[model samples]
Target: MRYLVRDRMLAFHEEAWVETEHRQRLFKVNRKLLRLRTTFDFVDTEGRQMASIVKKALTFHHTILIKQDGENVGRISKRKFRIFGDRYKVTLRGGRRLRIAGNLWDREFDIADDSGTLAHISRRWFTIRDAYAIDVMSEPDWLLLVILAVCVDHIIEDREGEQLTNL
Candidate 1:
């Protein structure tokens, strides 16, 4: 599957079966790095986990872009770790079953299915504080761009009352 998160994009594929296995690969790009950790878990509607299959961590590096309202923001270097198999037969606690196939790019991620359709993308930004405990510059300027992109895409997709959830 394929999806665009901000200026970043990712794609994945899975086999048709009750369960599948995925191999994790690592890469690096300049000063940026990615450590992707994949896992399988049964979760409830509240996102609580029921069971988890832990895997190894895949470390890599890549270039990432962060933009807000089509404007460029700051950038970040990141690494990814895959904690489980790339392929999984996820059985949600709600009785919904699906194959989880996706990857993480720094603070952004794209998850998709067999048809190369995006299920979701996530972006995050953090605030940094100093010795005086004063709020300093916000971390990950690109996160704002990612959030804006997701919001715009959500509006275009018109999922109806779908609210953005902070990670």
Candidate 2:
């Protein structure tokens, strides 16, 4: 399964769409504004909340929690200290671990575990600028794959913002 993720910068708040390859909208990535913690809600086409990617506050390393039905289904956290490219860890509630590795800053990477690659996030499609598609290989975890891609994007943006300073 492949899904297109497009940023809607023109909106009053941060917003985006998770759509099908043919451009059929599947989910709306709505950023919640004026909140203590950074958050984004993934809503289905029928206006139902599918899941939420919430930035965990007061943490040393960047961490985003994926919640479904108010339960922590999975988590994406930046791994501390790496000699080469940046690395992230995805932990599922089931105690399974997946690692995100590759040119994450460029949005080209792979989400995989000990078993194998779960999904591939890339810009090879290049339909829209800053837009990327997640080619999900595992059928059962498609939602997790889609939401994981967005969580990676959010973490990257957050790190970039933290690097700036007023001098």
Candidate 3:
């Protein structure tokens, strides 16, 4: 399946939607306001919290914790060393290591592990700047993967001083 995401105007509190190719809203990413740390909450269309990514304020590496039901389900951080410049490493709660590598800042990349490539994410300029199209392959945990991609996007944006929600 393919989905689209659009960039939001610069704001301390930002909001955007994860939608299907047909433009149906799937999830909402909310960067909460007045928080000590940057937090992006994912919610279903019905307004139920699906997951959240909370940035670590003082970590040596750029790190964020993925939480569902108030429990950490995964963690993503920048790899100190990369043989080929793939910057982020995702460690799932169940001991799965997912590697993300490609033209990341350009919004094109792949998420993969020992098994194989899981998904391809790339920016699609559909008359709107900073739009992304995510093509999911045979991964059963596609939702998490989508959230993961968005989480990475959020982190990258923060790094570039685009949306410094924590401030």
Candidate 4:
């Protein structure tokens, strides 16, 4: 007799970007983490302006308040948080979590279930290409490539913005 264990896992790649007259912000999703803490510099394509944002968003708080439609939902306190490198973890109120690892201007992310089946939540103009070998599971490789793309896109966008502003 064979016993099968059904482990439900979902994963997907995503990218986010915002364009403005003066600047553009982008982010890419990478691996998920239980806990993350780090700092990185933000530079344009020319590698100028070495400023950074110090972030410390974790998942150990007693209760995380999620507001929807200006209404407060029930408190959430038992979710896991994962941060690999400069990536950020996005958690929804409904036990669903999205691990994002790119920049605010251009990013790539994956939404998955606990068991690891990849899913496509949404896609935008930004691209999510798969490259590299990141983990034994063959998922991290693609995630890294996505992150790189996001960073490059942000740098280019920033450069363009700066040139326009100077004119």
The estimated TM-scores of all candidates read 0.20, 0.93, 0.87, 0.23
- Write the residue-wise lDDT of candidate 2 on 22-124 in tens digits: 9999999999988889999999999999999899788887889999999999989985556788999989998999999889777799999999999999987
A best-first ranking of the candidates according to their TM-score comes to 2, 3, 4, 1
lDDT per prediction?
0.27, 0.89, 0.83, 0.32
Model 3: residue 139 alpha-carbon error in angstroms: 4.1
**What's model 2's overall lDDT?**
0.89
Which number leads on TM-score? Answer: 2
Per-residue CA lDDT of model 4 for 85-145, tens digit only, reads 4343434445555443333233333323366524221224323332211121334433322
Instruction: Please state the error at residue 6 of candidate 3 in Å.
Output: 2.0
Q: Report the error of model 4 at residue 112, Å.
A: 2.4
Position 78, candidate 2: lDDT: 89
Among these predicted structures, which one has the highest lDDT?
A: 2
The TM-score measured for candidate 2 stands at 0.93
Task: Give per-residue CA lDDT, model 1, range 1-167, as digits (tens).
Answer: 22122211221321111110121211111111233532223233344432322223432421223332343332222223336623323332334333323332222333223444334333333132100011112233222322322322222232123333322
Which ten contiguous residues of candidate 3 have the minimum total lDDT?
158-167
Better of 3 and 4 by TM-score: 3
